[model samples]
Target: MNIWVTSWVAADDGVRLWTATTGAPGASWPVVLVHGGPGLWDYLGPVAQLLDGNRVVHRFDQRGCGRSDPSDDQRVARAVADLECLRRHFGHERWAVIGHSFGATLALAYAWTHPERVASLVPLGSTGLGDWRTPARAEHARRASAQQRARLAELSGRERRSAEEEREFRTLAWFTDHADRERAWAWAAQDAAAPHAINWTANRRLAREVDSWPEETVRARCRRITAPATVVHGAGDPRPAATAAALAAALPHGRFVPIPDAGHHPWREQPSVLRALLLRAIRRA
Candidate 1:
């Protein structure tokens, strides 16, 4: 069975970040899971458990998110620096980095800035480089039913939402993130109810920074990264896997993997496949 231990790590700016470590008691290979949502708290707990206690897994709430102390600094650079601080606090010279969605983008940025400090990078369901949201939005609309779409629009048009209304809105908003239409609502609802409310302020700030990255400069940086990166995305995700494939191609040592019949969160739909791929990647790294 996997054992979990929680602790606190201070970022360079002195924000107290909540962190946890788990897995086989003496597991060797160290891996850190970075959750998506520039503003969301750590939601990779399931992924860590899916690792099957084979390696030490680390997870943390980013600054101003979840259990971490709130801070005014929401810069992308600061987030990367906070990750480095977490690594140093754990005494890992190099470690495997696994990130999902926006977290994937952040992981890429981290690897680009600190190539030598990263052993391997696994980006799961990332938005990828360039403009991916347009296609993604269209896909999401197509996947959502008319009633779901109407309800979502109604909730979004609200000037202010009560707690229940907000949850409903979020659930509907995320309903298209799964390929399994029957299960998508449940999965999205679970996500909406997860601890640590979405930090919209931090999301806006960090998203702006992410959007500012010039494509050419980003590709040039990718070419210089030493660690291997595996860009894995769901075949049914709203975000086009082709964009992720292009991202992989731009990297010096990057490969792309597309999971069948899965959407944004592949683990929820294809746990075994994801687990096998992750185990192999971590062991090889």
Candidate 2:
């Protein structure tokens, strides 16, 4: 079994971000995994473990989230700069960049900013460029039952929630993110129990920055990035996979891969297929 080494990497602004890595330097090209959420911590440990044993894998919590130091400066540009700091600290000339959910957009933005430093790009279940949230919310609502919706509404309407109530709220909120509805409750409940709490401030700040970018602008940037990009999405995701296909079409060397009978987090339901796609991207990189 591969052993992971955990430590802190200081950013340009003296903020410390927690990072974990597996495998030795020079063994193979390194890959950095960026987890979803502008506010959530590094929860991509399973994704890292799924990679080839001979490859080095890196995971980190972004500044102001999880184990990282709290900071008022939470801009999209700042987040991109922090990622560059991590790369320079590790002394890598270029590395494969993989991201999930919102992290995927951030990874694409990073590549746009520093194309020369990205050997390859993988945006898994990315919140695609353009207005996808409305349809996504509609699909999520369609998937949720009346009782579940009521419970979610009640919890969200509250001024404060007990720990148990918070967990329940999260479970309900995330229940639609899996293809297997029967097991989604259990999986969402497990996810709700994650150790790190969401950083609402960081989430709001960075989300605003991301929203300001025009679709045409991002498309223009994508066209400039020459790195091979594979945009992966689950067929059952509330966020339409067509948006992901559009992102792929924007990139010069991008390809869109849809995972059948999967949702937002494909690896949770289709680990083997996701792993195969990831390995293919890494090998090509």
Task: Please tell me which predicted candidate would have the highest TM-score against the true structure.
Answer: 2
Residue pairs of candidate 1 with colliding backbone atoms? none
User: What TM-score does structure 1 among the candidates reach?
Assistant: 0.96
lDDT of 2 at 94: 93
Cα lDDT for residue 129, candidate 1: 77
Off by over 4 Å in 1: 25-28
- lDDT values, one for every candidate: 0.88, 0.89
For model 2, residues 1-285, the per-residue Cα lDDT tens digits are 275678999998899999998865555578999987879888888888788477888899999999989989988889899899999998899999999998998899899999999999999999876788888999999999999899999998998888999899989999899989899989999999987888889888888888888888899988878799999999999998888898988899999999998998887899999999998887777
Cα lDDT, model 2, residue 44: 85
Estimate the TM-score of every prediction: 0.96, 0.96
Number of clashing residue pairs, candidate 1 = 0
Window of ten residues with lowest summed lDDT in model 1: 20-29
